[model samples]
Target chain A: MTFFYISAAVALISSVLAISRSNAVHALLYAIVSLLSVALIFFMLGAPFAAALEVVIYAGAIMVLFVFVIMMISSGPGSTQQERRWMNFRLWIGPSVLSAVLIIELFAVISPPREPMSAKPVIESKQVGIALMGPYMLGVELSSLLLTAGLVGAYHLGKRKDDAAQTEDVTIHD
Target chain B: MTSVPAEYGLILAALLFAIGLAGVLARRNIIFILLSIEIMLNAAGLAFISAGSKWGQADGQVMFIFILVMAAAEVSVGLAIVLQLFHRIRTVNSDEANTMRG
Candidate 1:
């Protein structure tokens, strides 16, 4: 229970930090921490398979892609300093106020039940697979198709138009 | 083992979702915007898992797997578009993408 509270705090603080950063890479690092903490929360909730997937997919694979893009687009040190200079204190007021309101709303609404914890069966990965394959098979197939389409679309959109050939032989400047 | 209340997990998930919303509404960089969307997706996944726990079922985890696949597809397509935008305009700021503006 204490571990759950600790991870939840970590997730909240890190997510706050992530959204507030001006540097994309810095924000991404904090987002990874936030995801890992959420994975811990999943573990505490007795969903170990979900926890592992959260860590592997969110914190690991997706974040690496983000880092790759950030590096690909970064201008240089001059841009780093420019990003820091662009971080005006006034810009944070909106998000901070919104977050505060949400925090207050959550605390006001959630009243824990007095009943003590009861023994629950551990959910194994095998059970998750069985359930997925049984009742949710359509969802699984659709997801695979969606992933394939996304891959093809990404490839098509990302290809450079100029790579093939120039339409005109030379530019005609009047 | 001292088990925590389900409300605690729900509260945390709600807070995370709110933070993600704030990020989406406030952040100007497209990458940050996409990242905020990912945060929100994860928050939803958390809620589902917590709800499943409350009911003592694996349905929540199953839903999370679907969410995971959808998120992956979204990121791939989104980053591809981001890459294309960068190549076209040389900027990643969302506000600068006004070519379609009338």
Candidate 2:
């Protein structure tokens, strides 16, 4: 229980920091910390399989993709300077207050005493796999289809045009 | 035996989601916006896992796996579009990308 509270707090604080950072790399690093802490929470919740996937896929693969894009764009120091200017108190204060209110409301709604459920067995990876293959087979197949389409779309959208052609296309589009 | 109540797990998820929502509403840079969306998606996954744990069912974990798949596809295609947008506009400020705001 102590570990769960600690990790949950870590996740919340890091997520807040992740979004508020002016530098993209700094924000990405915080996001990674936030993700890892969430994974810890998942582990404590008796969903070890979900926790592992949260680490392997969410923290590893997805974040690396964001890092690669940030690297490729290579926003100079000037960009961070601009970001700093844009991320002022005026811009963030409203959202922060609104979110705080929402959270408080959620806490109120969720904190009411309720009957505790009987203890059940932990969900293992094997059970998850069986569930996926059995009743959720259609979802798995559809996700694969979505992945294929995303791959093709990304490739098409990301491909570079010839330099001269690009200039001409930009002129026409603008 | 799981020690923590399901309500606590849910509260944590709600907190994360709120933070993500604030990020999405506040950030101006497109990358940060996308990152905020990722955080929101993650919070949703956390909620599912917690609910699954409550019932001792594998379904929550299965749903999280699907959420993982959806997030991966979203980031891949989203970044591709971001790259294209940066190439065209030379800037990642969402406010600046309002050329199509007819």
Question: Compared with the true structure, what per-residue lDDT tens digits does model 2 show for residues A31-127?
Answer: 8878888877786677878978988999899999998998788767687776576566665553355345434533542366722222445688999
**Residue A170 miss distance in model 2 (angstroms):** 4.4
What TM-score number comes out for model 2?
0.82
Name the best candidate (by DockQ): 2
Go through the candidates in order and give each one's DockQ.
Answer: 0.46, 0.48
Q: Over the stretch A1-174, how does candidate 1's per-residue lDDT look in tens digits?
A: 655666787789889989999878668867887887788778668788998899898889999989888877876768777656546676455445534543453343233742322344557798899999999999999999999998998898778777432331122111
Q: Count the backbone clashes (under 3 Å) in each candidate.
A: 0, 0
lDDT per model vs. reference: 0.80, 0.82
Name the regions of candidate 1 deviating beyond 4 angstroms. Answer: A75-118, A163-174
- Name model 2 segments beyond 4 Å from true: A75-120, A163-165, A168-174
Quote model 1's TM-score for chain B: 0.95
- The DockQ-based CAPRI class assigned to model 1 is acceptable
Residue B74 of model 1 has an lDDT of: 92
